[model samples]
Target: MLDLRDVTLVGESIGGVLALTVASALPDRVKAVVASNPYDYDRRYADGVRRGNVFANIAIGSYAIPIFGAINAALENRLFLGWVLRGGFYDKRNLPRDLLAEFDRVGRRRGFRYVERKTFAGWRSWNKARALYKNVKAPVTFVYGDHDWSKPA
Candidate 1:
């Protein structure tokens, strides 16, 4: 069969793993792949949510964005700085500071109840990723900095 042409794919975090799986399942269909901070499907893979980050999970999942405070509590200038430094994204400079403020501003509109439920569901569903990781069959290229996987929080 003629190889599929120009199959371009991009991924970030767990989406990276999924991209790899797709390429593998149909090799002829994929010509290239790019992944940023991709998750290691292997259970043994490290750099999962570390203990300190738990506050984020809790804040977003449990506390919810009650109001303006959510911005200060979760995505404050300082908090964003910490994540950027610790996040291990190679191109951290590319991320805009104003976006953080916008995110906070917009997120506040959602209110606590909505954010809390979303967060709760988010954390609850991550387990399914473990199963997906074990079965990726595509030729995969991962782009990640050393800090991408912080010690378990």
Candidate 2:
């Protein structure tokens, strides 16, 4: 376990939602939050992808399926991952090769794919986590890239 105290939490994408959730739960320990491209605004999992690409929206929906989802996850190679991730950046150059490599490495881990599939399958529950945002007493700074899937509203 980590011995955390008076901390500032920073996260991107779904991780941003996680940071806010934790800060709300441990209000005294968390001092501030930096959330970039948080997934909170989307009412449905597919809605987030719809803002970016139609094909990606369909693919994201398919991730909730059992057998087909496993097949899709298994078929995700570095090129495919790069293609999907590059869309999130306003300037593709911002996504360095090393960062993409690191993401690829992490995605290939044993249970990582399973976790991603499960997360997509239970996206409604995760989306509901936005309700916890009001409970977060810590000051939050939201960051958004020009081409981020989440719109600044």
Candidate 3:
């Protein structure tokens, strides 16, 4: 077995889900946990939206369309990417140049787009794992931003 020490787990977004799973399964190995914007798969509001909304259905279903890749590529173009990134922030006017540059840099990395798409698709399948959250024994901290759109859901 590998020797591990001082294991403080930190994760953001879906990675938080994975960190929670690990902490739950190996509580003794984890010293502490910090998760940012972690998703709650069992949220009633999200379930209701998925079941009741046509737009949500369309957005999810569009992944299967043949032209989806092309559309994604077009949207990720420089001009549109700025718009997309700005829309994600509550205060778009003051976004740091370095952050946008970092986003652009990361977006251009090979296979990043494919992995991002797959990660989102996998998010829908995480409901079954929600039960595991209750089993985590480590001290956990969750952080969220007030302006995040996901906060209301």
Q: Over the stretch 1-153, how does candidate 3's per-residue lDDT look in tens digits?
A: 887755889987667778888888888888888987666552432332233235443443454355784365435655545655555466867668787888788878888766655655565555656688788888899888887544554
| Residue-wise C-alpha lDDT for candidate 1, range 1-153, written one tens digit per residue | 765655877888666756765665666677777777655432321224322244443443333334554444454444553463334334656557676666556645646435534443354334455455444444456686665553232
Residue pairs with colliding backbones in model 2 are none
Question: Which RMSD values do the candidates have, in order?
Answer: 6.9, 2.4, 4.7
Q: Please, what's the RMSD in Å of model 1? A: 6.9
TM-scores of the models, in the order given: 0.48, 0.83, 0.74
* Location of the lowest summed lDDT over 10 successive residues in candidate 3: 44-53
Report the alpha-carbon TM-score of model 2 versus the true structure. 0.83
* Candidate 1, poorest ten consecutive residues by summed lDDT: 42-51
Q: Please give the TM-score that candidate 3 achieves against the real structure.
A: 0.74
Instruction: Judge candidate 2 at residue 88 and give its lDDT.
Output: 60
Candidate 1: TM-score? 0.48
Measured on C-alpha atoms, candidate 3 has an lDDT of 0.64
